[model samples]
Target: MKSTIAFLLTLTATLLSHLPTPSDAFVYPKTPISNTVWKPEQDVTISWHDDKHAPLLSSSPIFDIFLMTGADDKQKKLATIASNVDGGTTTSVKYHVPHVSPPGQIYFLMFQTKDGSGMAWATRFTITDSEGNPGTLRPVIPEGGTINPGGIGAIISSSAKHRKSSAAAAKPAAAFADRTATAAGAHAPVKAANAPAASVGGGNTQEENVVVGGASSHKESSALKASAGGLMAVAAVVVISGLQFLGF
Candidate 1:
């Protein structure tokens, strides 16, 4: 009987381990999306709908947002607006567009991590430098403000490294769905139905939060959690059956 119980518990645990983690629901915010044309230097805030995953990273994961150009059935990387971003070290990261970027048609925001895994959102926008009066596009800084010059180089360097590493295969952009939310407690994890497609870069695009302790250890920790849950369930069932058999 003990052996039987043990086998059932093991099986249950194994099954549960395969269940999805919170990271599966993690995504960029859907609300307040912009389709504005801007200049080379601008500020764009990367927003995510899943709040619980805001802080769970192996290290502060760097997000590099880029503009992808499609030609000859191959997608070429254009300008990089944001790089090496920690996302406010909280949930949202404010990124400044680099001066190296030029005026062009923007598809949308496509970002990848250091490991090459990424998500891309399809959008219709433009990047231009003409003044407001006769121009259809918007300046990065409409107020004519300036960004801190110090950090731009570091961001650029990191982006270059990423480019080199993934030079072999650059997947065409995917349809990254926008999930909207305000804060950490706003939306429940499982409630999220849409997530960005994983066709862009690498890793589990559905990958959830630091809760499972980043992407590397996610599988192991999920298995552990499953084992624990299985044990509890089996113990409960056995106790109940035994109590019924006793019949007071």
Candidate 2:
């Protein structure tokens, strides 16, 4: 009896192996999660568009939210919400983010079917203030300022101050040029006084040399002419004395 029972169990195991394993029946949606943002400390009501997913997902499919923390796609169960599908009607669902999640921490939201065998989707986001939001849909600063601390108003103020300073720097330099020209003009007389001393000293020295040479030349010429006239008179007197001594 024991041998017969063992033979029957072996036959059943072999037959089951030959048969095909049942495939998973659920279909996953390919709709992307859009309009993602972050809110610090406050309850982050995370939501996404689910209208396109109505056809693939069950009419009342239950959602399982998973946050992929660290490596290996390890799922950290976060929250779950029910999908709204009313005969092809479009709708959305929300999941509240934990307040303890610090700023700039990477997190992923994975929407999966309850059976864990349907088409799964995941989108990444970071917790941050509005100004400091990361990822593709980051917050935009205002026209004149930056995000103040974490809001749009601070951004506007920062931008305004930046523009004001830039405008002041960009003003025309004409006024500065005029002031420089005026200062240069005022110093022109001082420059002339410092320059003329060397020129005047050279001119006076040359004039003194010319005057001394002229006076010395005039005195030497007059002395030479007087000596020549005295020699002629002495010669005439000597000749008259010789004639008288000879009694001729």
> All candidates: CA RMSD in angstroms?
18.0, 54.7
lDDT (CA) per prediction: 0.34, 0.28
Best model per TM-score: 1
Worst lDDT run of 10 residues, candidate 1, spans: 146-155
Q: Give residue 188's error in model 1 in angstroms.
A: 34
Q: Predicted candidate 1: what Cα RMSD to the true structure?
A: 18.0
Residues 1-248, candidate 1: write the lDDT tens digits: 66655665666554444333444322354421445554434565545543245333434444554444321112234455445545335345555544222233322444445343333333334543322111222212113222100000111322443232232122112211111111222112231133232222211122111111111112223333453355457656765665555552
